[model samples]
Target: MSEAEAVIRNQSGYINHTAKKDYGPLEFTGRIAGGLRLDLRRRLPLYASDWTDAFKAENFQKSLSSILYLFIAALAPAITFGSRFLDGTNGQFGVLEMIMSTAVSGVIFSTFAGQPLSILGATGPFLAYTLVVYDMAVGADVEFMPFYFWVCMWCSLFTILVAVFDLCALMKHVTMFSEDIFAGLISLIFIIDGVRPIIENFSENKMSLTSAMFEALLFMYTFGLATYLSHFRRTPWLLRPIRNLMANFAVTISLVTASALAAIYSSDTNLRMLSVDADFSPNLVLSDGSKRPWVVNPMGIERSFPAWAIAYAILPAIGFAVLGYLDQNLTSVIVNRFVRGALTLPVCAVLGLPLSVASTVPSITHVISLTTYEVKQLPEGERKVPSKVVEQRATNFLIHVLIGCALFLAPALKFLPRAVLQGVFFYMGIASLTGNNLFDRLFLWLIWDPAKYPQYHYIQKLPIRRVHLYTLVQVVCLGILYGLKAIKETSVVFPFFMASLAIIRKAMRFLFTQEELELLDSLPAEEEDGKGLSPEQPDLVNLEKSKENDEGEPAKATMGV
Candidate 1:
């Protein structure tokens, strides 16, 4: 086969299955039924087996490690978003609500989702929409909770409708062009979010020099050391098993070590600490000036919502429903495959909690935590990539179970420094970029010499200009998304802006030739050869199917294909 043809044939991850399906001639209702069937079409047969594998005795050890890593991975954001909810909604929702939403929604997803490897949590856009709803309630002189409840209720209904209609089958239109830009934006959010707080401490000049410096040091220590240990397996310093163990537990080790480091400066008042409620009581105060109950009465909120408001709620609901659809499905596709999010909507809405969507960092981190990497010495350097992922639900199920348990441990969790968590944020953002194709290409600009470029398929097979053009297009789209997400007034349209990326990607055909696009966009040949966990086999892991050497090392990694 021609090199370009091979590239095209090897390419995967587009929603081709849905796009190509011949759901025989059907009327509207029939199509809707077919669409719903299509949602579970691929996963249904595998459902029973998925559950069996989840509880295998051998999976427990790995699940335990993953549980610890993901617990921290999931916790930081719950606290962060909870704080945002409290401030944005005037104590209508806070840490308690956020935790409950995550813990509850996560348990449901882990127990029933086709791909439980993906994690769900509140996202920034979700937070922005909640804030907008709060503003509407305030302007209308209505109770925020009732309006919020109705909005969430309508959102849940819309989300279910989208799922029922199988609207996500349209994902066939999305491509790496859009997915990478979205991934890049999410990654930058993590990196920037991590660095922003430390920089603010210095810029705002809020604390004593010693305290600020200590905070900065703590952040660096966590990020730098964790990064070093995560790659420990790549080095020749220890026994193979020992290095692997360290690499697997890198995040857990980093958090523990950082927490210990922060404890040394517990007396330093300027160092920010994680804030959680001493109890699990609702933060919102009712009209009677009493703490609201956990269960929000849809019809009996503090202020009696007008009947028109019930219908009016659909306006905001449309935005959130679309956002949830995109975030949940797209991130699912990014991690591995599509999974139904229709179930999470109503549950979160009724609880008056921030609705959870697929969290990019944590979901990807969950995959990485379960992945076993094989390191090989190459002429260039040591190439490390995923060989297999211990796909199971037990870890996710137990992780959130522990998160729910955190309600009782709030007093202890409060001791963790905010800077330490931010350090993890920085580490996660930086680590996630390791396998990003866009990130790799962006770094290519630094190499002026052609001979120095790594022997990546695209770099070797495609024209350098073609590769650069593809990367540039993604960069432009990322800039637009960043703008949309950064401005409050524009943020509500953020989901639509994300939708625009698919259109932008489609428009790229006019810019690059079909052959060039394939080489630039396709997953590597090994990935399509059935030796990876994610069908799309996204660049989230620097995966390459290495061939066997004379020593008879296995020709393929155990990808559980």
Candidate 2:
């Protein structure tokens, strides 16, 4: 059994706790996405204790193995945000440039203190930030293009210093109090991003919830079939080859295939066609030589960033630096909840710059989102690794290099229906919620004596309705962002509202809670011998009384526990 699996066996109180959660109509979505199996116990290990076996000496190998996943994860943010930065008019090279940049960053991270399964790439948070920055670039008199890159360059430099300085250790200081707030913030991001689009589309596009539901269902079914097939090893028949070929290109390839096949059948509600938005116009094909398309100003735009004047943006650079570190550390801690092993930020630093560039590109994010959604939703035991560092790094660094090579060679790439990319973003939203259940679980534990969380009991500290309500609201938010392209329409309002709402709600909870908090107080010290017998091992709880200490021990729960 893997280390993570052992923990599950040891910690039944936690899993049994959440088992009764009513999955609702969208229940299958969670199972299909591996949601039911997501180990909530991972949250506990974020602290220092559940780690008797943890020793961070040889995780480099796992980090290397993690490269493949990281490569894909990075792809999501890269493509999603990168496309925006690429030329708005007749631009094609943005995709290629973004791919290169992401690959470069992957190489860097693969080289240093990498974690194998944590899967770093351009994330939704970073992508969100990019949108805000890009908006600043638009219509600004300042040469924002260079300003942007200049800021990135400094952020990169700062990240490298931070990594080298081992600032990742600061994550250890992140208190459970703060962690709950932080995780709640991230969870809100996922939810709100998904919802707003669905709500707005109800009126704007006149897309009935039924139509939206169908689209969602199709997306899920197609993705489910792809994932199922990818995992298939039963018969090496046509299913294996076809599944492998299709999944390799991901949803992008699948959508295109469905489109062509649909055209042939002329089916109702066309399932596939070159899935493009009404605003997007296709230009040169992959075969056609394309010019380098960059989002920039030609009329003397180089003065600001090129000159020493770029240094003035140092404070802004500091802000981005903090954001990147916070995101990275939080993600790593979440990963470590289940995945043991030491990871350093130095490698991340080596990779962050290139990653930003790739994120600046468009296709990479599409790839990352689709892939990460699938991988992250897998069960705990299925995802667990050892508690060693160098071993993880060595393995993942090599894998990154391999995935990077596949990325560089465009011909070997293009395969899937790009629609899966959005699915990936959806999956991530789910992950953000379940990834850190520590606070809720901890609160529940405090409420319960030695049994389990409230999901297993009749009544909970907080209303089950509240948890479900928030989750549903988040789904609505996610629908809005992904479906309506809220980044262009209502991105800021949605995310801000989600985050702000959480703050307000949490504050209210703090003020209104009537339940008294429990503190772990110690039992009084009993006198031993005249000289003090140094509390001689307090006779084993379940063991029969010792010959010398002629008394049966107390029950296990009331004893040491």
Candidate 3:
């Protein structure tokens, strides 16, 4: 046989068994989606015959898992933060509202739209800004949350526009380094934001930063121990359906147990117990002209500007436009990376003015958080991304449809607790960090004596002495930011400025020695294989995949088969 047919025949054999057990192989129906149907369909296989049904199933599973993931990523931090908000403001949402809200925006964004697996919901910056705004708006006669909801609706509309236009390709210029910096920016926010309250409450709440951190650490250990015991006992084994989605149920179990203990011990020892609710009564946001239960009509007064503020608005608008563009497209590009569904920058842009209004959280700031998912489940015989990536399109569509249904039912969701969701947020924050490559890279640079942790050597080209200099710069800068963030107003400025420093540093790269430039260039040249995990590294460690075989982008996209 010729080379082409040999490859095709092998791929065909591969797809038949993998895509679905009952399915024989991929065959085109001779009809396309654009209302073109031909009876004598050739049943021509995919461009790559190695596609399989089992692989498709795996992708579907990953998409489904995202629903649970989004629910958790959002609520875990939210529950804790919400409790703190109530402690600060004295309101309650019960467990239901807190949990539902976490899933609400995520469900609407993921389900109604193409980016089902994108995993949207509350972000730290948005929450920070919201609390500040909500507090400020309370003093004014005008509504607060109605404006927030209006902003979300606007952003959602913009997202729809992006999906229609298919402008996601504009994201090609965003690099891995840029993405990492943005993610670091978010994580830095988490640590600092999380720290501020802990420090302040240290005296009034009778807590210390070290003690709270220790309590958080203890909570981690408790969950770890519980997980180990659960696995060790093997009682949950009979629960197979839930077992496949163990992480989903894990937050519920851990937080409940932790809260039980906190409640019991809280009164005696002054352990901070989480608040149970997040008050969502339509306050100033909807009080005026409160006609429909949840709708508002803004009297079309020309959106005004103060004489002093009017001049400043345009420059900030330009700045907002730049940051908004960077944030949304960067997020869209990353979303498209893991998710099979198409993501468009225009979607973010369409949502742009709304995001600026509702919550001007930068899009690129998303990469700061991360999650790891299996891209494809390789068959026993076949290898590479050819397996799951084959039936990617159909599976993605199905998953989004399912998530949409869930979102439509989101308001009725019952039984989840606020603390549990907070635990989920805590878990997601920790889980997303799993995708970060920096911690180990830095550890290697600082502590590892070069002889060990060779992977660090590959990632950062500087020598041991130079590694110390790099570590010193990072530590000192991060320490200063951590300290200054306590002042509240100063926090946002530091991160934006810190990120700006990177631009300056990149420009300064030109001043380096030719040899230093060569060394700097050597980093990240080793590309990841399109495959999910490398076989060489057993425990989710990524390896350099052969460059030739990198999947160009989403297997299913505007490019078409």
Candidate 4:
């Protein structure tokens, strides 16, 4: 086969040779059967065997970086969602519960999940739904715990049924267009959330205007410093290792430096520290100064399960199941496009589960924080691209375990400045947005000169109008989801909105040519091949091309098959 044909075949197998294969109607039984059979064959073996082949002595630095990145990353959501739960319910679900759930879920997921890299934690949508359920129970004059127990039990069953039947396979229809928009929106939310506190404090009349202004300025300084350090790679005076260290630990260092500065500068001013309330005890308790057991049976004979609730609960349970399945699988797809794993729904049922939230932020930040060094060429030419010393999964696993252990230290972590975490979130948001293809294309449109535009494959092959249309669709979807999330009542249906985006993507084939759609949806050939290869097995052809480019040689054209 010729080179171009080989590239196409290597990237997508037989898909390009035929008319694009249409996924017919969703087959419920077939999917279930497939999942069951696959489970029987692989689940036991995988569970029994060692999954930690990814961890090695060589990956120590990468693992350490991951632990540090996740510790800070988990802290934001833990505080945000934990506080939300506490405020909404007057401290019914305490900070300890939130931290405990996060730590426990992380440990369980990292150990058992097929994809260990995907981080799991308390999510805004799940927390919103919980509050809604709590309010509904209160309005109905029902005991909140019993009512919650029934819903969770039903939701767990539904989640298991979905997983056992392999309904997640349907997610194959979700293309990069949908994934990018969802991820981008999340990133934007992080940035907005970070800035919101400063804005709110600035407007408050309680604090003096000068103090408020100083707080806002402090945030800007922190954000600016973090962004600068994270992106600072071009300084020649700094040693290579030192430069890499700064970039890799930029967020952690910036947070510390900024916090110290704020503490000293705002010693007299009333600057806010992260509001975390924990007694550092293992016991679970109710808001009414009542003792609650750590392990209460949800379906106990003592508590009556209302007949009406059984009927009412099924719908919400299914909704939760859909939400869990979609969020988990979507996160897995985004983290490592190659490895898709099934979640244990039964476990989620027993322990109030945490959904994977803001996974890209931590994963990307972990990668960015690692020190990389460029290898010099033999003689006097351009240096090779900087390379990471280790992979990130082992670090991901360890971080979760550490966070679980760190729950006891919650009292100390409360002193960590909220503004510093906000600055980290701000950095995370910008990083995520910048990395998306849709954002890259949008940026290309802003450039006044076409000659200055980068040679992206889509730009060269697809009509510019079509490209813009595709981007417009993503932006519109992002706006809808973001709007839904901002409104409390609608946010629970965020997963449905995400599913709708996938459906919209499937419909796009009618509007655009198959080849163009394929290009938009599928991974590039180099990336596709690289996914299956070890780091030592470099793409020799690409390497050769890079060398030729460095030596200023004209590229040769490949013959068509």
State the lDDT of candidate 4 residue by residue for 85-194, as single tens digits. Answer: 65456545645667767666666666655445556676544655666666666766665555666666677666555556556668777778877776676566667866
For each candidate in the order shown, give its overall lDDT on alpha carbons: 0.67, 0.37, 0.36, 0.56
Better candidate number, 1 or 2, judged by TM-score: 1
C-alpha lDDT of residue 41 in model 1: 47
Taking the tens digit of each residue's C-alpha lDDT, what string does model 2 give over 1-561? 246544654566554534665222112322322222332233333323222212333323223323444444345444433343342312322344444455545454433222332333454555555555445445344454455555565665676555444455555443333444444544455445534443454467645556555455544654455334323322356654353333333433333444344344344442322222221222222234442123333222334344543664454456566656555555442222111112222222222222331111122222221221111123222221112222223333443455456444443223222233334434334433432433334344345443444442213344544444433443443454344334554433443343343344345345334231111111112211112112122211111111121121111110000
Clashes of each: 0, 73, 29, 2
Q: Write the per-residue lDDT of candidate 3 for residues 1-561, one digit (tens) a residue.
A: 124544654665633422332211122222221111110011233223322431454344443443334333333444454443443333312223333343333433433332222434334444444444334334433343333333333433443333333334334444443544444545655544544444454456556555565455445544453344323212445353344234224544566566565545444443444433123332112225332332233321223222333232233233332334345453343222212122222232222111211111211111111122233445432233422222222222333234334434333332333323333334334333334444444566545454555554334555555444443444555556445434545533443444454464465355554454344323343324534334222111111122122331111100000
lDDT of 4 at 152: 67
- Evaluate model 3: give its TM-score: 0.55
Order the candidates by TM-score, highest first — what do you get? 1, 4, 3, 2
Between prediction 3 and prediction 4, which has the larger lDDT?
A: 4
lDDT of 1: 0.67
Worst 10-residue lDDT window, candidate 4: 552-561
Instruction: Provide the lowest-lDDT 10-residue window in model 3.
Output: 552-561
- 1-561, model 1: which lDDT tens digit per residue? 124322433363332544544342121324554555543544444556565664567665556767876786687668656755765677788777888888988898887775678787877557767887787677767777777788877776666666566566677677777767766776776688678878888788878778888889988998888778766655789776676557655666777788887887687657777666676777777768788877777665765667877777777777777776667776553112222335566666667788777786577767765665666565444554456667767788888898898777667766777777777767766766766778889999899998999777888788888888888878877888888777766766777878877777777889988888887787666545434333212345432222222221211111100
Candidate 2 worst ten-residue window by lDDT:
552-561
Once superposed on the true structure, which residue ranges of model 2 sit more than 4 Å away at CA?
Answer: 1-95, 114-118, 160-170, 184-290, 293-312, 331-392, 408-418, 438-561
TM-score of each: 0.78, 0.48, 0.55, 0.73
